[model samples]
Target: MNIDSIKNYPTGSSVKHKRKITNALEYRQESAELCDKKSVNRGYSGSFTGIGINRAAANDFKNLGNTFTDKIFRSKKFQNIVEIFENKTVVASTLVALIVAGVARPLTNIAMAGDKDKEDSMYAAAHAISSAVIGFVISSIVMAPFDKAFRKIKDDPKKYLQGLEELLDVKEIGKRKLEKSKPYKKISKVAQMIPDTLVLGVPKAMLTIALIPPILKYVFHLEKGKKKGAAPQAAQSQNLDVNNNAVKNNPAFSMIKGGVK
Candidate 1:
């Protein structure tokens, strides 16, 4: 072979090898760029998917809460309770008073005492009983007529609401319309509460305080007494027993006892 031909052959072979290496490097760089773009697209898609899921969960929770509330509001027991509170205002007020005065107050007093004793407990109980009795009795007697009138108004709004048309802001009122009126409902509820909360509250408390001492002395036998002659005491005890027996045997007393039971 010729020397010039051999040298040219080696140079051409080297140039061909360099071009192949450059092509390979370019292909690798293009593949890496495509991978990066795909990764970014996947990341964006994943974030969107997460956001959609969260929004769906939130909407589901809101719907569930609304459905639960609607069920509670439409329940029969809830309606009955509301009916009783509206119709038996005096009785409802008395029950609240009894719970606060007869049950909660005595328990609170005993719990708050630093050094508890029988005398302290007895005194608290006596006050509680007296307050409960006085509040029940007075509220029943005082609010009966008002409750009856309100019932009459509820039953016959067309007849009863004629006098208070201006105050109620409706020219024509019927039972159905009055029941549906939000403003009238609110006003009537407040009016029903006024006798117990405003008119009778302070007076009942004062009367209860006044009667506590007498209740403790006579009912609970809390006071100390001087000894009496045995013969007179025996006679008094006999008469008291006879009176109690007679009262117990009375037809009216028997009927009352049965009714209470």
Candidate 2:
């Protein structure tokens, strides 16, 4: 009989109703299993998964940053500055790469060369190598103060801000609870971008600039990858495989491990 006809007997005695109940039970079990998976907690109020402040977002920021640097380097006014960086950071291996790939790569091949050949492995290899040098040079020169500033903030953001306050002729740090001021917000974003500029921005930009044929190589190419600055650090669980195995194998380990911690 249909479920509608089951009113003649108690609900559990109805086969259709029992089947529906079994389905619900299975659905609930599946939902419970999903809850056991990882979810990023949303700032104490809620939680979400695979949404907002993710890796792709950070990579976008870095790529944008590298594009900016590319413009700066390509500017006619910045030739001297770029040269300074090229001179300062280019070590022996980089010097060789710069000379060989930058100079020889262009003059050696005519018919063999052309950026339209996207599948050419030799071109990509030469580009990645040569671009790495220029990338290191530009990032190193420009990011010196940036590196120091980020390091200062990373170690102690409060102290760094307080130092700025003292320099600005505000009351000493301990005299009052130092707070964010208008100028702080203005400088915060540019200041925070330094790390990503070094790590993701430079490397991606290197691959970018390197890929161009000898003429426009310095003016183009940027593939920004990450922004460590904006991204909050994720707490990592330590791998203790031996300890886990011991606890599983010996129930007595539960007491010993628990008590020690």
Candidate 3:
């Protein structure tokens, strides 16, 4: 019974009943605490298990990345490409220029399309072609002498690199030895590129710009009979139309126009 029922019983019986009730409550509290401890232990175990699983997955991914990288490094085709780029520096540089000017620049211009003053895609193509041609021609001509000189040095490092043997810390440097030296190879590549980078770059760009108009006229037949004065007025009128349309469609302009009305 409850505490109220114990009050109607004898004093000694009531005290005994109260003791029994207290013992039951203490046992239930202890059982609840034990259950809580068991749940906490289970939570810790599950957390550790989750951590172990994540660590295993991470390790698997790491091993897979390493394996893929190792395969690429060991591949014969990859090695051959690397060897070609290292040995055929002129070819490498020319290919880079072609990609930048002919491929990348033209693609960028086409993607940008009508964002600029020159709306004609053919003009962009012509410019890209001119740039690529000028870069290839000028680089080949200018780097040829430097390449020949470096080749001579590579052929006989003993004669050319005589005084710098001690600085390089190698005795009797051979062609193979010099080729294998990373620092020397880097220096040789940079030295070969110097004339093209410093001397020919700006002059070649200027020459390309000077040649683009004639190329567009003769080769592409664009703007064939247009007068210079008319062309400027037409271009300016087109730009004004574009700007007016942009303003008319703008959200802020719409808000201002609505407010004014």
How close is every model to the real structure, measured as TM-score? Answer: 0.49, 0.23, 0.49
Model 1 TM-score, 2 decimals: 0.49
Q: State which candidate has the highest lDDT.
A: 1
lDDT of 2 by residue, 125-171 (tens): 34444454554465456556665555566456566565677553445
How far in Å is the alpha carbon of 207 misplaced in model 2? 11
lDDT of 3 by residue, 1-261 (tens): 364464334445656544534455654564455445755434332233222344455465565536878789878988986875665565567667677756776676567666443444445455556556656676677666777787788778888887675666556587766755777767777876667667765676567656656766777665524522112111111113235335543666765543321
Model 3 quality (TM-score):
0.49
Q: Write the per-residue lDDT of candidate 1 for residues 1-261, one digit (tens) a residue.
A: 564453234334666644433365554564455445655434222233222344455465465536877788778987886776778786676767677766876676567655524445545455555657667787788888888888887898888667665667666687765765777888998888788778877776567556655765788665323322111111011113235335543565765433321
Clashing pairs in 3: none
Ranking by TM-score: 3, 1, 2
Looking at model 1, report the run of 10 residues with the lowest lDDT sum: 229-238
